[model samples]
Target: MNPASHGLKITEQDGVSRIDFVERNILDEANIQQIGESIGAVVDASPRPRLLICFENVEHLSSAALGALITVNTKVKARDGQLRLSNIRPQILEVFRITRLDRLFVIHGTAEEAMDTFG
Candidate 1:
């Protein structure tokens, strides 16, 4: 499925579905919602979703964005699918750690590594 906003880019290959968050900073409340919705749309459209969310270009994530990620993670779980994260900046990673969300989500050094988990 095509993303409603340009903040994300979706790609599927080798039975692995990936969504790359294209924005430099996911600090805007609206953009955060858009990213969550786009993720939901892509997961809804997939037959059997195995999602990798790449935060390679995202330097910062706001509290709302963090909430959105949690929401999407729930959606993925409800679909009996998997969700992984990759390329998170150190500062953002610290946020995840502080929130203890790092334990809630499987994170990787790269999108490729996250995608491989689906295999």
Candidate 2:
């Protein structure tokens, strides 16, 4: 048997957590859990408002990923924080629309846009 795990790199900046996926997204449970934990860690570390930026590494996203994000977004909102996304591909945009998460979360056109919004 063979196994593959998606790549991800997370950094902190300006009171926000920047998550960059180093590999293509498969939306696997491992990745989803990590994503959730990352958000939880940030919130637990400080329940203050935060902006989470995803680099949109994959053209297609998995349902698990989206669900995890929705959960994280709800958590952020509960803590008076915001979850923002960037670098979304056109096809993924369609998925967001299909799921209506596009309306729920802030999807930025680029990392600069996300940063500029706060500034």
Candidate 3:
């Protein structure tokens, strides 16, 4: 299933699945829920189940969004799948660091680097 939000772009290639955040901030609860549902659908549908979420365009993230990510991460892990994050802005990256989520996810400087690690 495709993401309901146009702000998210989902793509799959060579057994690697990527979800790119096209928007700058994920602040609203509705958007957060939509994104979470979209990610959940992707996790459920992916065959190889290697998911990369690119935060290249995201400058801000809300608590709800962070919670959604954690939920998706758990779902991915439950399926024995790999979930990664890439291109996180420094300020936004600090949230992960503060929340200790940085230790939970495999983060990379670029989407290509994250995809490479899936190999």
Candidate 4:
């Protein structure tokens, strides 16, 4: 399913739903909401989803974006699904660390690494 309108590029392989952000900065609240909704749909579509969100193109993200990610993570967990975040830039990783989200998420250095973790 193509969700380009939501500024995301999605692909699936080996039962893993991988999402990549099209925008470099995800600071807008409206865009963040759309991203959350789009990803939520992906999570709901599968009984046990394996989602990987890659931040390779994203350089900056607002707190609202983090909230949206949190919401998506909650939905995935509620459905007994797995969510992994990869390719996060150093600056954003610092933010995740500062907010203690690093502990909440199963993050990896690369999408390949994250993909390998999916059971």
Candidate with top TM-score is 4
Q: Global lDDT for candidate 2?
A: 0.72
Residue runs of model 2 more than 4 Å from their true location after superposition = 1-6
Which structure among the candidates has the greatest lDDT? Answer: 4
Model 2, 47-110: lDDT tens digits are 6766655657776568998887788777777887767889888888889999898899898988
lDDT of candidate 4 over 1-119, digit per residue (tens): 36543899989889899999999999999889899899888898899989999999999999999999999999989989999999998999999999999999999999999999999
lDDT of each residue in 1-119, candidate 1, tens digit only: 34474588888777777778777889998777778888888778866678888888888788899899899888888888888999998999999999999999999998777767884
Candidate 3, 51: how far from true, in Å?
0.3
Cα-based TM-score, every candidate: 0.91, 0.83, 0.92, 0.96
- Scored by CA lDDT, what does every candidate get? 0.83, 0.72, 0.86, 0.93
| Rank ordering of all candidates by TM-score, starting from the highest | 4, 3, 1, 2
Model 3 deviation from native, Cα RMSD in Å = 1.8
- Model 3: weakest 10-residue lDDT segment is 1-10
- Backbone clashes per model, in order? 0, 0, 0, 0
Model 1 TM-score, all chains together: 0.91
**Deviation (Å) of 25 in candidate 4:** 0.5
Poorest 10 consecutive residues of model 2 by lDDT? 1-10
Clashing pairs in 3: none
